[model samples]
Target: MDNKVPYSLPGMTESFLFHESQLIEVGLNNAQPEEVPPPAFVPPCISIDVSHLFTTDQIFPTRDDLINWVHGIAIENGYVVLITKSDSGGNGSRKAYVMLGCEKHGKYVPYRDPDLVEGTRTQKTECPFRLKGRPMKNGIDRDWRLKVMEGTHNHEPARSLIGHNFVGRLNSEEKEQVEKMSKSWVPPRKMLLTLKENNPLNLTTISQIYGACKRLRKSLRGSLTEMQHLLKKLDGDKYVHFERHEPGSEVIRDVFWAHPNAIKLFNTFPYVVIMDCTYKTNKYKIPLLEIVGLTSTDKTYSIAFCYIVNEGTDDYVWALECMKSLLADQAMLPKVIVTDRDLALLSAAKQSLPNTSHLLCLWHINKCVLAKCKLYVGTDDFAELVMGKWGEVVDAATVEEFEVQWMQLFNMCKDKYSNFTSYCSTTWLVHKEKFAKAWTNHVMHFGTTTSNRAEGAHASLKKMLRDCKGDLATSWDASHSLTCNQHTEILASFERSIHRIDHIFMFPFYTNIRGFVSNKCLQLIDDEHIRMKSYGGCDCLLRETHGLPCGCELAGHRSTTLLSINSICY
Candidate 1:
C-alpha cells in the first residue's frame, strides 16, 4: 500500500500547502522556522554617582533651598530628583523631613477603572536612587540637612533633560522675568534665550514659557470668563468700546474698540479713510475689521478695530456706525473711503457714509486682474503683456484717452484670451471711475491710489500679535501698545516738520515752507519741479486732485516759494 499523502485536501484544496508538503515528504525541505519573541530592553551599564553631593554637614537655609540644591545636583549628574513624601507640623511637636528619590524610583500602580481610559505606559523601573532631608539646628539658625539613602540607579543617566516636565519648569523669579518680557511682546524663543543666559542650568523650554503665560492669563482673569474680563479691561482703560448681542438673546455678536489717541488722530486727519478686514487674529476665528487714517506726513494710523462674528453687510454697517460715532462733528466725516472689492463693505460704506465718496483700491484691482489672467495664460511674459495694456487703460489722463485705451485692450485680448477679457469687463470695467486715473485724479484722494496703508497697518498689528490663538483681552493689549508707539512716532514727525528742515530742502523755492510743511510734501513738490524741468509742461493733475501745485503750475519762475504750508492739503 502507498503511504503517500494526497496532493491536496478535498474541500481545502486552495488552502493546502501542497508544494511545501511535497518538499518535506521528499526531505527537500525549507520548513517554517520557530517563532521568536521580541528582544527585551537592556539598561545601559554606565551609571551616575550623586551620593557624594548629599551629606549631613551640608545644611541648607530652608527645606525648599535644600530640595532645590539636591535637584540641581541630580540634574547635573544626568538624573532627576523628585519629592516622594514630606511631613509638616503646626507646632514643634513632630520632626519635619522630606523623602527625595529618583524620578523613576517606584513602579507605577495602575488604577483599574472602567470609566477612564488606561494611562500611557511608563518607563519606571523601581530605581534605587534615593535621598532624605530633615530640619537641623546650626548655631541659632534653623536649617535643613541632606542624607544619602541609596546611591545607585537601576537605569542609565539621561543624556538630556530638555523636555522633562518637572525638570523644565520655570522657578518663581524666572516666571516673573517671563511675565515682564511677555508684556513687551517678546517672542517665546527670545524668552528662552534670556532665561538660559540668566541661568546656565535652566532647562526651561519654549513650550514651558507658553504654559506659564497661559497660566498667568488664567490667573489674571480670576472668576470672570474671557469675554467678561475683556469688557472689564476695556472699561478700565477708558476705551471707546461697543458690543452687540444677538436680538432677543444674550450671545454676543460683535465688539468694537478705539483708543482715545486713535480717535484724536482720526479727528485730526479724517479726509481719506481706508477700511479692510483681517482674519485669524483671535481664538473665535472672527473677522477683524481695521479702519486706518492717513496723517499729514503720510503716516498711517489705526483708527478703530471691530471683531465681527460674520462678514455680512449688516455686520459691516454696524462696525461703520461705531466708527461714525467717533465723529463729534458731522462736517468732520471722511470725504473719501478706500477699500477692496468687498461688495458687503461697499454697500455698508454707501449706507453708512452716504455723502462720502467710495473709491476702490487700485492695488487690489490690479492684483485681481493679474491673478485671473495668470490662470488663463501659460507664460508670465504673456501675462505681463496683458497687464501692460491694462495699465494703459487705468492710467489714461482723460476720458477720451481711457476710452481709446480700453478699446485697444478689448481688441488685443478678445481673440486670444477671451476669459480674462470677459472677467475684466464684467467685474472691473464697471467700477472704472473708482480706480481709473481719469476719474480718480479728479477726486481729492490726497494722492492715495491703493489701500496699502491699511494693509501695512495690518501687517504691523499681526507682527506684534505673533499668535492667533490669543484671547480678546490679549489682542486688545497688543493693539493698545502698538497704538501708543505709533502716536509717539507721529508726534515726533510733527515736531520735525515744525522745527527741523533738511539740507535737501535748502532751495530758494522751498524757503517759506521749510519748517512748516512736511518733508513728504516738500519731496512731492521737488519731484514735480524736476519733472517739469526735464519733460516740459503737463496736465496740472496734482493741483486738482491733491490740492498741491503740479509741474505745470511750478514751471513759471523760481524767484520765491510758489506755495505756502496751508495751501498743501491732505
Candidate 2:
C-alpha cells in the first residue's frame, strides 16, 4: 500500500526514494505561500515629543511671548495652536494664565435655523491638545513660563498648514507689502509669490490676499461709498468728470470723465473719432464706453471713458453729450465718427453731433457676417467660399459694382442657402451705406473705417488694470497713468515730425512740406509717387477720401519744384 520506488538523476549527487504521499505533499506546498509583511511603522500623531521643546525652565519676557513661542513650535510641526482662554487677573484675584489648544479642538453643536434651507458644516474634531502659559512664580517682572497640559491630539497632524485661516493671516510687514503692491495693481498670485520668496514659511493664500485688498480699498474709501470715492478721486485729480443722477434720487445713472490733455488732443485732431463699449473691466458689470481719436502723426489717443447704466438710447445720448462738451467749438466736432452698428449709439451720435457723419466699422460687420453664415452653411469649404464672395461685395469700388456683386452672391447661394441670403438681405444690406467701401470712400475718414483704434485702447487699458474686478477709482488711476505716458509719446512724435526727415523724402517735390508736415504725410506722398511709376493711372480715391493727392495728382505736381504744406489735409 506504500507504493514507494527509488529514483536516480544524472546531475544528482544522491538518489532518493519517492512515494505517492510525498509527491502529494510537495504539490500541496508548490511555492511557499507569499509571506504577508507587517504594516509600516507609523510614528505617533505627534511625531516628536515636542512637549520636550516646551520647557518649564524657560521664562518668556511676557505672556504673549510665551504663547507665540509655543504656537510657532506647533506651526512648524504642521498644526495651528491658538489661544483658547486667557485670564488677565487685573484685580490680582488669581495669577494670570493663558490656555492654548488646536484650532480644530472643539465639538460641533447642531444649530439649525428653521427658516434656512440648509445647515452649515464645521471643522471641529474634539481634539484634546492643550498648553498653558502663566506668570512666573515671582510675578514681579511680568515674565511668563510655559507648561504642557495635554500633549496629544485626537487627530492626525496636517501634512501642510496652507489654507489654514490662522496660518494664512499676513503679518504687519507683509500687509504693508500687499497694500503697496495692490495699489500698483500687482496681481494676488504675484503678491503671494513675492511674500513666499521673502519668507519661505509664509502660508498666505490668494483668498486672504483678496480679502486684504478688499479691506484696504474699503479703508481708503473713508466715509464715502465706492461711487462717492470715485467721484472724489476724479475731482481731486482734476479730471473733467460729469455725472447724471436719477430724476428724484441722488443715485448716479451715467458718469463720464476725460483728462485735460485728452480734451486738448481732441481739439487738436477732431477729424476722426471712434467709440466702442468694452465689458468685464469693473465689478459693477456695467459697460465702459471708450472713445479714441487719431493724431496727425498717426497715433491713437484715448479721448474719454464713460460708465453707462445701460446701452440704451438715453444712456448713449448722455455719453455723447459729455463728449461734445469737450469740443473747443461746436464747429470743431469730429467730421467722421466710426462705431459698430449699435443702433442706440448710432442714433445717439446723430442726435448729439448732427453734423458728424456716422460710419459702421467694416471689420466688425465682416466678422459677424462670417460667424453667422458659417453656422448656416454645412461644410467649411462652402463657408470659406461664401466669405470670399461676401468680401467681394463689401469691397466693391462703386455703387453700381456693389449692387452687381451682391446680385451675383445671392444668385449663387440663394437656392441652397436661403437662410444665409435672407439674413444678408435683411440685416446687412439695409445698412450697406454705413460700411461698404463704395459709400464710405466718399467721406474724409482719413482711411480709418473701423473701430480698431478703440479696440486697441481697450486692450492697453485692460493690460494696465490686470484684473476686471477693480473699482471705478482704480480704473481711473490706471487710465490716468496711461494717458500721461501716451501724451509723452505724442509730444516726442510731434518733435520728430518737426525735426526729423527720412532720407527718401529729400526730393524737391517734398521740399516745402517736408519739415512742416508729419513724416507720415511725406511717406504717403512718397508711396503715391512710386504708385504713379508702377501704374499708369490712379482712381483718385485718396483725393476724395483723405484729401491727399493720389498718384495722378503726384504726376501733375512733378512740374512744380516744391509743393506747399497746405496741400496736405489734417
Candidate 3:
C-alpha cells in the first residue's frame, strides 16, 4: 500500500514525487483551455439557370462587382453558397472564378470512437454541388462572368427557398404547415412565428418561410399552359366565357363564370342583383366583379363572377353582355342592379341592360357624404352634422316629403355651410332618385341599401384568396374553393327547409309557402304577422319597398295567401 505515491504526476517514486510536488502546483496554475476554431461556411447544393448571372464586361466594374452579382442571384433563389475558395489577379481583379459549395457538402470530418465519444458531431458532406466564376481581361479591363455550374445532390435541393441564407429552405413537416396555414389565409409572417413555436429545426429567415408558402401556392396555381387544360376539365353544368382584347395575340382581357346554381338563382330572383368589384384580387390588380342575388328568404345567392382588365365603361358593358348571354334569356332582365357610385358602371349598365333599373347604393351615397364633409372640415362637428342630416334626408319615406325636407335641409346647409351644400347639390342631389328611399320605394331592393352582398362576398373571397397575391390561375383556385363552400351552405339550408323550421312562428301560410319560396321569406312573413298584430293603421310601404305584403295589404280581404296578398316584384 505504501508503494503508491499521491501526486498529480503518474509513475514516479515517493522521493521523486515529493521533489516535483512544488512544480505540479505551479504547472496546474499556469494551464489554459485549448482553443476551438469557428465552423466553416458551406454552400447549399442549389440548382439554378446560371445564364442571368454572367456578364461580358472587360473590367470587373468594382473589386466586389462579380461577387455581388452571383450573390444576388443565389440570395434571390433561396439558399446560401459561401465563398470557399477565391483567386486574385495582380491588379486586384478576380483572375479566375471562385469556388463555393453547400454548407452540408464537402470537407473531411475527424473520426471519434463511440466508446470514447466526446461532445462532437460529424456532418456528412457528400453533396458535390458547386458554382464557378472568374474575371477575364479584354485588353482594357477585367470582365466578370459566370464560367461554370457543377455538381448535384443525391437528395433534393432546398426548402425555405430564395433567400440569402440556408434557413430559407423548409423541410417536409414545415412545408406541410406552410401549405395548411396558407390555405387558412394566415399571412406569411404569422406563419413563420407559428412554425418557429412548433418546429425549432429549420425556420429562421422570413424569406425561407415565404419561399415555403410560395412553393405550395405555386403548385396550386400551375403554368399558363395548364389554364386551357383547366377550362376543358370543367363539367357541363358550368358556364365559362373568355374574351380577348387583342384578336391577333388572343390575350384574354375579360372572363365571366356562372354555375348552374348561379343561373338558376338569377332566374328566380332577377329583380335586384348586386355587382361589386373586388380589387387587388390577383396580380394584375384588375377588378373581380361579384354578381349576387337575394332570395325571398333574404338568403344571398351567387349569380356570376366577372374579371375585367379595367374598370372602364367598355369593360363593364362587355361583362354585362356576357352575363346576359349566360342567362340566355334577354327577356328575363333584372328589375334593378345595385352598384356603387361608379359613373362607368352606371353608364355601362344603362347601355347594356336599359330595361334594368340601375340603382345607386345608399351606402355609397353615405360614403360620398363623408368624403365631401371630410374635404370641407376633415372630421369635425360640421362633418358629423352634414353626415347625420344627409342620412335623414335620403331615408325620407315619401317623394313629396323628401323633396320638402331636402329643400329645407339644403337651404339650412347652404345658409350655414356653402361647400358642403355645393357638394350635395352638384353631386348627390343630381342623383337623388338613385338613392332616395322615396323615389326607389317600390323597387325590390331586398331590404338592402348597398352592394353589401358583393362586399361580403369579396370579404369571403379574400378569406380564400388571402393577402390576394398571385396570378390568374391562383384567383380561379380561390373562387372554386369559395364556390364549393357556398354550395354546401345552400344545401344545408335546403335540408333544413325540407325537414323542420326552427325559432320561427308557424302559421298555415308557412305550410303553403314552404316548398315554393325560401325559408327567409317565410321568416319575414312571420315577422310581418307579428308586426300586423301591433298595427293600428298601415301604408303599403313594406309591400313597395320589400316586395312583400304589408299590414295594410294584410288588413285587406285576401290576406296571408302567397298569390293574393301582394305579387312579388319580380
Q: Pick the candidate with the highest TM-score.
A: 1
* Model 2 residue 187 distance off true place after TM-score fit, in angstroms: 2.1
For model 3, the superposed segments whose C-alpha errors exceed 4 Å read 1-209, 217-239, 377-385, 507-511, 514-516, 556-559, 565-570
lDDT against the true structure, per candidate, is 0.83, 0.82, 0.68
Clash counts for the predictions, in order: 0, 0, 26
Candidate 1 stretches greater than 4 Å from native: 1-61, 109-123, 136-143, 380-383, 555-570
Q: What are the clashing pairs of model 1?
A: none
lDDT of 1 by residue, 1-570 (tens): 543445656686544554545766766656665568669555566566666766558768888888889877878878888999877633656677889998887876655874453555676777878888877742222587888998878777789998888899888899899999988999889999999999997888888899998898899999998889989988988899899999999977799999999999888888889999988788878788889988878888899988888899999999988998998877889989999999999899889999988899998899888888888764578777888999999999999999999888888888888898899999998888889998888887887779998889888889988979998888888888888898999999888887788787887877766776777777877887889899887787767666677886677767335343235342
lDDT of 3: 0.68
Off by over 4 Å in 2: 1-49, 62-64, 86-99, 114-120, 134-142, 375-386, 413-419, 462-485, 488-492, 495-516, 556-570
Which TM-score value belongs to model 2?
A: 0.80
Supply the TM-score for candidate 1: 0.87
RMSD of 2: 11.9
TM-score of each: 0.87, 0.80, 0.65
Tell me which of candidates 1 and 3 scores higher on TM-score.
1
Candidate 2, residue 89: the lDDT equals: 72
lDDT of 3 by residue, 452-528 (tens): 88888888888777665676656766777677677678667766765667555354545555555556666666676
Task: Please state every model's RMSD to the true fold in angstroms.
Answer: 5.2, 11.9, 20.5
